[model samples]
Target: MRGHLPNAARIIDGFHVVKHANEAVDKASKAEAGENPPLKRTKYLWPGNESNLTDPRPEVRRDPAKRRSKTARACGMRERLQDIHADSANRTEAEAGSKALRSWMMHSRPEPMKALAGQFRRHRQDILAYFDRPYTNAILEGLNSIIQHAKTRSRGFRNMDHSGTMIYLTCGELGLNTVTA
Candidate 1:
């Protein structure tokens, strides 16, 4: 289903992918925080006590420190996952996801996904046209990652310009050679 281009791709897959990522993130978050609905580590379920996290996998216990509230953490994770999706990003994620969107664009040109080919046959030209593009949106994603990391380390920006300047400069440093407004 994901082996097609922008046109043939179904919108549902995007939601599914993001939803799975969120589940993973949420499960890990709760497991760490010891919050509502205690989560068991499947192969190694941890008891409420520290001594319970015993097993071959090296006693792993995550402490969800007060960096943010549980709800805040969940929201942030969801946002990040959503950011990887284009339809939700206004082509923002397309910069990275659209370009580096695997599973769909990976396969082959000829005998492409039959279902997808049939669906976007009319739009094939535009879909295949992606090759002509000089760069992929992956770069934007890289820039976003840098920005996220910077914010994490610096502990949020003072304001919009402050954050924007930092992100812009970071993009430049990372070789976003051509800056578009």
Candidate 2:
């Protein structure tokens, strides 16, 4: 589409991009956990917020050594990336954050994170565009999920129109009293 619409701005959803990084962190955590006995039942450590590391939960607070492992480093990277996304108030900040993320990814020990960094580098421009608009397809994705659930609960829609109506009723957020009036 970029070839056909030269003037159009391309944007990548920040949430989606960060999900890849999170996946890498999870992978690293699983690998590390498998090798270490203490970390065996602590799979929840990696995906948790950085603050959760100090939480009162025995699983989290009990293991200081777990926080020093390679998985922790990967989780740290994930947390930093999340901070970058949250801190970017404008395009310039976003650009700087993206650069920092790229640098961190390049040095990251996990192969998956390195590959994710390469992907971000390739689409850097589109990813940066997200700072300008701050819009994401998350809402659409949620609606799609709801529609799928609706379809599954009812077995299937008889046709396209039925499916469309189901989706509209589920996702349109309509006021029935007003519509009836």
Candidate 3:
């Protein structure tokens, strides 16, 4: 990107980074579940913000800090990274947070998280660039999701023209003045 678009701010979306971190945590949980009984059926509890955790059991919610499994540790680390992203208002703060997270993950026990640490090292600049230019492809992703839903609802449109029209109709916000002026 730097070769062609010299002036472009190459940013790595924080959302994607956190997503991969959650995936890594999930992978860690799966691997650890074999040796650890507590983690056996808790696969669904690993992914998502630490605050909005989805586990229905009240005991599970209160006892996370007591659990010392790799999965729990990985979840904590992922949450820390998410918090860093949320709190960082400038590149300096983000870089500092990234450095701390990278070091912690690099030394952490989970293999998947260690791999994620390597990723952070390689894409440090791109990740920090997000703080420099806070922009995300969320709108595009949402539009694409809407279009996909529209396509699914249509269940294979008759032709390309119809597909295109369906996508536009699903995604576009058209103003219809029904009342006569």
- lDDT, candidate 3, 78-103, per-residue tens: 98999899999899998898899889
Give the number of the best model, judged by TM-score. Answer: 3
Comparing 2 and 3 on TM-score, the stronger one = 3
Q: Whole-model lDDT, candidate 1? A: 0.43
**What is candidate 2's lDDT per residue for 1-181, written digit by digit as tens?**
8898987777787688778888988788777777777678767756778565564654563367876777777777787888888887898988887798789878977676787789889988898888887788777788888988767665565787766665666667755553542
Prediction-by-prediction clash tally: 5, 0, 0
- Cα-based RMSD of the predictions, in order? 16.5, 3.6, 3.8
Better of 1 and 3 by lDDT: 3
Model 2 — TM-score against the truth? Answer: 0.77
lDDT of 3: 0.82
All candidates' lDDT scores?
0.43, 0.76, 0.82
Error of 1 at 28 (Å): 27
Ranking by TM-score: 3, 2, 1
Give me the candidate number with maximum lDDT. 3
TM-score for each prediction?
A: 0.26, 0.77, 0.81
